[model samples]
Target: MSAYPTDRQPTHTPVMLSEVLALLNVRRGGVYIDATVGLGGHAAAILEASAPDGRLLGLDADAQALAAARRRLEPFGERCRLEQAWLDHCAAAAARHGFSAVDGVLCDLGVSSLQLDDPQRGFSFQQDGPLDMRLGDAAEQTAADVVNYYEEADLADVIYRLGEERRSRRIARAIVERRPLETTGELAQIVQSAVGRGPRRRIHPATHVFRALRLEVNRELERLSGFLASARGLLAAGGRLVAIAFHSLEDRIVKRFIRAAGSGDDAGFRSLSKKVIRPSADEIQRNPRARSARLRAAEAV
Candidate 1:
């Protein structure tokens, strides 16, 4: 009973939908904010679960994605408000929309399927397009800018730390030798050449490099940090904060944030998920993109 067409459905399945709903504990008359409401899939579900009186504030940096979300959420009328903004601006956006201290908040971190499926966004190595990997107009740099201009040492560091790639030095050396790379295909080829496809390799050799470049171009980690720092203050007592992270680095940050908030003598938060919730086998089979998703949730004290 999906609202999206069959062909477009696969591109934007809301990962762990049931889990998100359970974690947020959506209820009628509740106020919620979808910090990364790409395509409005989750927002629609939340509105339905909350029924007639619930309100949602949806935010996204990508204008096109925001526009799509607006259309998808139109049936809810004024109950859903869509905004084009980064997750780090969630607190401000919530305040502006009179959603301060909402009943629940959700932050789905990492790139969306909309961005990856669009070859023009350059988030995936599987598709050939411009090396531009900016998540939105707000990004000051692009994957091409980083690939064509960064020093070898800095590039290596970015690959190693952000991408978690062991052969970062080798990859960076290869990229430097082939300067002025203009497209994702060219960069993917260079990385693949430098890091040969191992017999047991299940993923593309350039996966890590592309991930690193996208993270750098969008300053994702920095913004996630900023969002986490401000998230608690925007929640009313007993309000839930749910975050779904797609990578280990992002998960680690969320895990640590929740852990710290629940530890002190004056602890102002409580862990709602004892361990991180991950997609079940059935969910993964239905939506392959859910494989790496990890959800962590906490409630304000």
Candidate 2:
């Protein structure tokens, strides 16, 4: 297990925290689940709001994150259970921890601040680190493996399809020419050179490519889709299922899933929000990362 420092607290700020608490409707004696409880920001709040006898199950794929969460939530005693598991295994983990039927389930999807802020994790472009971007230890392949070994055509396809980059072909060609890349800084420089570092660019030139590799390395979309298919099974009647997605790809999946699940007369679930929820200007100022977050909610019928 990765050792997290206890001298100082983690700097993770839970996105739309108030909104999540409201949507979950946490109450005393109720049970809840944080499907991606990074650093236990949301989990701690959930436990506090559902005070007295409420219980929570926190699941995460990253061992380092779980360690941090365990420390942060230790004050809650046995009211919360932390597990090192992915979103897809939430149901099984919940069941194992006596949370078979929960009052709420929250999935905060995509890469987290915990991963991005750590230079050694290689999830950021700002810092130079190894090209490894595996969110979970179980993942055998890393971003290095993908960029160093994938065929140009396949790499282009991954960047185009997953990253939604229009110049994926050009980027892939550049990457192919620079094989055996071992560090994030090296890859970022190559991409910037190939794509041109124009002043007009709103975001970094390598943003799309890095996001593509992270998604592919973690298989986030595939696992999210599978988790959503059976998510309702873990909820009790009227229990809310809330998701916070950081990117367009993840937001689209959540939007479509809730829409489809809530349709028809005999639907098992109903959409709680007709429109997507976003952070306030104050929130954006405090934590710039919350600017891209989109929240969608549904309730089991």
Candidate 3:
């Protein structure tokens, strides 16, 4: 329970605690993997519960997130391992350190609080910052580049299909007319102006657009598909895979993946959590970010 303040505060709060702990089925001497180890909140809890000889291999694409996780987990000493890598190839990365048959794998599918809080990362529409949205240190396509270079139709499709914005076309037109969006504040303002600034809703209008951009920048969905496939191959018999998804789309993917993994004859896994587990109202009140989290789990056959 050590929380250190850095230049950028981590905004991610690990959700669905009790459910994930139960689903993990941690055992002494077992090996575990926190496939999306962001700031070590869930990883810390897992390390404590699976104490003594149980080892945890935590992986994250964000180096800053990994550094935060390492700091939060420093007390664990040799019992924990932190690796900087995309979750899609984390299984291979895990094996590199001699964890070939892990007992459990946990992936929290939402962007970490750190990613959102760090203004320069550009995951938030609330804060003014640069338009960089890379998950890892990879210097690939950024939100800034996309906003400046993508055609009107492409931007509209990104906002419409990924963000589910009803006014995507108008927003896209507004964005295109603006010519260049150099910062998060500029982009958010354009969106607000197009939508005609109304009373603050439950969420900001630009929230989904930022999500869409981040997902595109990081190739989130494609990586998730690869991770699910690799995770099945990495787990041993009776091993469990616990996932916490923050949105409907992610939950749907997890639901479908678990179902496919549990099918007979050629099944890769068995259902551990038949239904998704949501955070308690108390948890949500304590950490508003937990309100949308959903946890699901499966066991390797």
Candidate 4:
């Protein structure tokens, strides 16, 4: 396990925290789940807001994150339960922890700062590290595998579909020509060289490519689909399910899931907000990472 300094706290400021609490309607003594509880930021807040006896089950794929969460939430004593697990396993974890029919479920999807800031984890191209982007320790494949082993055509498809990059073909060709790439910096350089620097580019040219590799390595979309399919069944009647998604792809899934769930008379949920909720300007100023967050919520019928 990665050891973090006890004196220093996790730098990740939970995105749209107030909105998440409001959407989940966290109440005293309520049972809740933070399905992607990285560093226990949101879980800590939930426990505090819920006060006295509110119980929480916090699950995360990364053991390092769970360790940080453990230290951060220790003050809550038995009020918070931390588990090292992926989003897809949330239902089983909830049931085992005696939290079935939970009052609310919050899924904060996509990469957390803890993963990105750790250069050794390779979630970002900005900081050089080994090409290992597995969100959890057990992933069979790594970013290195995707870049070095995938056929040019297959690589292009992954970048295009997951990263939504229009120049995926060129990027993939460049990467194949560079073969056996071993580090995040090497891959980022190849992508930047292929795509070239554009005028007034708001972000790095290699940003999307890195995101695509991380997503593929982690099977993030597949896990998210599984979580969405099962999360509603874990909620009690009138219970809420809130999801905060960072990118368009993730936001689209949450939007569609909520819409589909509320479409039919027999559907298990009803939409709580017709429009997506976003962080306030002040919050974005405080934490720039909050800029892309979009929250969608629904209540179980």
Candidate 5:
């Protein structure tokens, strides 16, 4: 059922595919960039819609994801160019690939299903694995380093500021009490014990803690801010910029950046949607991960 090769194909679906393509206004011969092209699902669709002449430059932080993307996008031959790099370097990568000004730029922010499903990557607490949560090999620190080395106050601050966890102090105290935490399972158990697991709870007790560590480990927020600043320059006049953010922190950044870019005398963009776009109920049912996706679009002025 997948367009990718049968061997080692990633199982993730592209979230809000229709909306992204529509908002991008993809057309034949148009050049585009997928700033976080995880697994190439959206890239493939964009390539297909663009038909014979459309060219795409796909960038990703994970080498493994880039490998999968390379295989999936190989059918398009020279029409697609992929680079293993973080979102923040999209403009540089685009320039290197001769895509200085593109018709559209898509940034599907946050961890992809490929990273979360792989226990070794340690983005989730559902399975036991190393505490490393770096999105790519370029990152210096891992979740283990943050959990085991940071002081209680610093840890609590990170959790509270990034994860917006109300019980960050309690959670940080618990983590400090159990120092030198090595695995995801160990960390998850400690947090659950500290937070008190209840049958009525909607999500795991350690969800925010894990999210915080991953974000901190990867410096995702900082990189996202940098990328947004460069995105306006990367787009040609009338070009579209489509961003899909998974959590409030990321969504809030995108919302404010677009709002500011669309106003004032130096106005560079015009927001395409008055309201944030969310996945349809059917999409959420098909892929539960789609439920949290928030899509925002703007056109370069």
Candidate 6:
């Protein structure tokens, strides 16, 4: 019974929803941030567990996403704060809301189910929609903009580096010749055509290309790097930070950041998790979307 429209196909399931509550160690009177809070599902649960005087601030770059979050968290009234902001700017957002030095932070670094399910949003290669892939309002370029604007070599670089597509040069050449791909389905077709005949299916040949486009459009990597550093600054002493990443590209960054922070030059923090925690078989079965989730936690001394 997902809330998203049927055509959009409910791709989000709040991965590791229960694990987020356990790791945050949430308690009464505590405050936390659900950075990249797509739908407010995890934030709502965190607020409930840390209830009485506990408050939760949920932030996301998409206004539409924020609108939906506001409704989902409305039951908590003033206990929940919803905003349209990137996680990297946590400190400034805190200052504006008269909040400071939270007891815990939760970041779920996965895209929302809404974005993927909505064919019009163009995040998925399954549907034939426009190439627009901007997550926030200020996105400078759409996927189409990137495809049509970048030179063949630049496009090759993007596909090669981000998508990990080995046949990047060939794909890029095909893309340039095709020129002005109008829709998500159209682009998928172009890539498919370039790929030629193959097995019936093998994870959608354009999967990597779509992933690279989404990450680039949202500036996810840069934001993640900044948020990791900024989150440390926004934590009170002994505070904890929990993050859930969905893919190797994201998990690798989270892993390195925790490793460095926990073993800083001055030993500023203690690593709560030496290894990643994954969802249980039951959780994965209930929400297949949780399959790729990797959870990591750390605490400020």
Q: Which candidate is the best by lDDT?
A: 5
Question: Model 2 over residues 174-275: C-alpha lDDT tens digits?
Answer: 999989899999999999999998899999989999999999999999999988987899999899999999899999998999998998987878999899
lDDT of 6 at 186: 81
Listed in order, each prediction's TM-score against the native is: 0.96, 0.97, 0.93, 0.97, 0.97, 0.93
Which parts of model 4 are misplaced by more than 4 Å? 1-7
* Number of colliding residue pairs in each model: 0, 0, 3, 0, 0, 3
Candidate 3 residue-wise lDDT, 206-295, digit = tens: 888888888778888778888998988888998999988888877888899999889979998998777788889899899988888888
Q: State the displacement of the C-alpha of residue 201, model 3, in Å, after optimal TM-score superposition.
A: 4.1
After superposition, candidate 5 runs with Cα above 4 Å error:
1-7
CA shift of 299, model 3, Å = 0.8
How well does model 1 score by local distance difference test?
0.89
1-301: candidate 1 lDDT, tens digit per residue: 0123435633378989999999899999899999999989899999999999999999999886787788789999989998989889888888888888888999887777777787887888898989988877889998989988999999999999999999999999999999999989999999999999999999998999988998899899989989988888898999999999999999999999999989979776899989999999999998989999999999999
Q: Candidate 2 vs. truth: CA RMSD?
A: 1.2
**Poorest 10 consecutive residues of model 5 by lDDT?**
1-10
In candidate 1 the C-alpha lDDT for residue 176 amounts to: 96
Against the reference, the lDDT scores of all candidates come to: 0.89, 0.91, 0.84, 0.90, 0.92, 0.82
- Give every collision pair in model 3: 11-113, 11-114, 12-113
TM-score, cand. 4 vs. native? 0.97
lDDT of 4 by residue, 114-203 (tens): 888878888888898899988888888999999999999999999999999999999999999999999899998999899998898989
Give the lDDT of residue 300 in candidate 2: 97
TM-score of candidate 3 against the unseen true structure:
0.93
